[model samples]
Target: MRRVIVIPARLSSTRLKEKPLTIIVDKPLIRWVVEGCLKTGEEVILATDSERIADTVKDLNVKVVYTPSELPSGSDRVAYALRDERVDHVINYQGDEPFVYTEDIKRLFKALEDFPVATLACRDTEFYKDPASVKVVIAEDGTALYFSRSSIPFMKLHSDLYPLKHVGIYAFRKEVLLEFTSWGQGHLERLESLEQLRLLEKGLKIKVLLTDNYYHGVDTEDDVKVVSERLLKKLSNPTTNW
Candidate 1:
């Protein structure tokens, strides 16, 4: 049961230019993600298209695989990178996401024991109205009902769980990934421009694990400032767990 964390980083980003190379605090954003994933003691593979992106983490103890820059999604980049690897499970850790928790990672992989696809979410009202932050609505059994860029489950009554901030990190069984990447883009996926929607449209159940841990993916200029302060604070306060 081998599990590997594959991080896909691209040089270009529509929201934030050179997102992977953007420096969060004292290090590059990609480096922060790489270092955190390394702490988990799992085989970490960095799937990137830029030499500049790969060079940032050149010193790290991680396998760097270069994929085509034209790959449509992060999931595709990882799948391309891992084409020759002998592994049972793969975690598509978004490069823009700087926050990485070991326990949360373990839980994601553990879910694949029963679920074909699994992801993370937390109760963050901060992302409720923010379109950049995709929101998710889950069923009673914890499987996702839908994910949308627009605010979902319109809270006329207001429940704490009504709005769950979808964490982009996804854990996929190797076979499931093969199936996902092979499918054509779905209607909802094309409209919303979210790759995960393609899975739900195809009747693939997505198990979303709720976590209290902090996760902030750098998307816009504002996120950089927020994450920089948070990273600096974490570095200063050795005991502070983010």
Candidate 2:
């Protein structure tokens, strides 16, 4: 089946305005994300609400769509962009995640063969447990039971066993993508301020792929500095682990 990746980018970020244009390692963050998405070898489209971001990526010879800014979340933006498209699957790539690994992306794509929706989760930290950092709980079969801003899988002793961090990447069947867009956000979605919960609330099955490696994203100016330093160091040491 044909698979396409759609990146949801907007000019209005609450913590860092015009975050898509922010540079990490002298390249626009969105460019890095699009580069990673392209590594999956799938057709990629950058869905954004601003002409600046569109033009910025256009210089990189990347495809982009002008989506409205009012969409509730990244999934909504991707759903809108893929409407009437011929692709069999769609993967929602966040613009801010410049450090996302291409191998991890391919793993999630491979996972979609057995699940309705596919995403990645990694070991959690204090940063991962923050309300701003959305969390997910997965059943033994590797299917996500829920996603929330609050910490999940309250364990008495084996809490370390379930310390999973939710990544923003998601692979969706074309129909499921459209269906998610059609449904209104649910109560759990509102309480946690996470859209993925709406899918769980609707009984949709989401596959959770675990990975040992993950990357931090640029959310604020401080985040930009940190990611920039990391990317620079990564570039400096080509043999270093990602």
Candidate 3:
């Protein structure tokens, strides 16, 4: 299938201001993400509403599509940017995940061959109890049963078993992505603020691809520093795993 990756960037990020332009080591965070995506050699497009963000991507000789600022979420922006394309599949990769491994991207794409939508998940930790760490429950067949910001499964007998943390990466068939944008916000989606639930509510199938590799995504100033330090460590020790 013809595949493309779209990074939904915006000028106003509530957590870190103008996050896409934030410098990580010697390059903007988005540039690192773009480079990682480049490793896959799939066509990539930056979907944004700001000229600053657009120009930044252009400076790197990367393709970008400017969408409206009124869009409710990144998923909507992705749908708008991809509306006219004849591509068979699209990957919604968050701009903040600078360390997104090429292997994870390829894994998600491979999972989508039979799944309507595919995403990454890893064993969770106590830190994931925070509502900000989105969690998911996967069925034995590798399908997602539910996605939530809160802890799922409500372990009646708590033990060392870890939950799954929903990594922000997602892959979908072109038609499924367009259909997702058309779906009205469902109750679970509205309450949880998770657009993926809207797809599940509409009876769409989502497959979960399990991975153990962890990448820090920039959500706050601290996250930026943390990821930068991690990158620097990797740079100094080329053999160090990220």
Best candidate (score: lDDT): 1
Candidate 2, overall lDDT?
0.82
Error of 2 at 161 (Å): 2.7
Model 1 lDDT-worst window of ten: 153-162
| Pairwise TM-score winner, candidates 1 and 3 | 1
Clashing pairs in 2: none
Best by TM-score: 1
When summed lDDT is taken over every stretch of 10 residues in candidate 3, the lowest stretch is 153-162
lDDT of candidate 2 over 1-242, digit per residue (tens): 78888899988988887789887778788888888777766788999999988877675546788888898788889988888678787888888888666677788788877888998888776654577777788788989888877767665566665767888788998898899889988998888777888889999899988888757777988888888887888899978876
Please give the CA lDDT of all the candidate structures: 0.92, 0.82, 0.85
Higher lDDT: candidate 1 or 2?
1
Model 3 C-alpha lDDT per residue in residues 1-242, reported as the tens digit of each score: 58899999877889898899999899888788887787777789899998887776675546788999889898899899998888998899998898767787888888778988998888867546789889998778988889998888687776454578888888999998998889799999999999889988888889988887876689998898899899999999989787
User: TM-score of each candidate?
Assistant: 0.97, 0.93, 0.94
The true-versus-predicted C-alpha distance at residue 186 of model 3, in Å, is: 0.6
What's the residue-level lDDT of 52 in candidate 2?
A: 82
Cα lDDT of candidate 3 equals: 0.85
Candidate 1 lDDT by residue in tens digits, 152-226: 889888796768999999999998998899899999999999999999999999999999999998988999999
TM-score for predicted model 1 compared with the true structure = 0.97
> At residue 56, what lDDT does model 3 achieve?
62
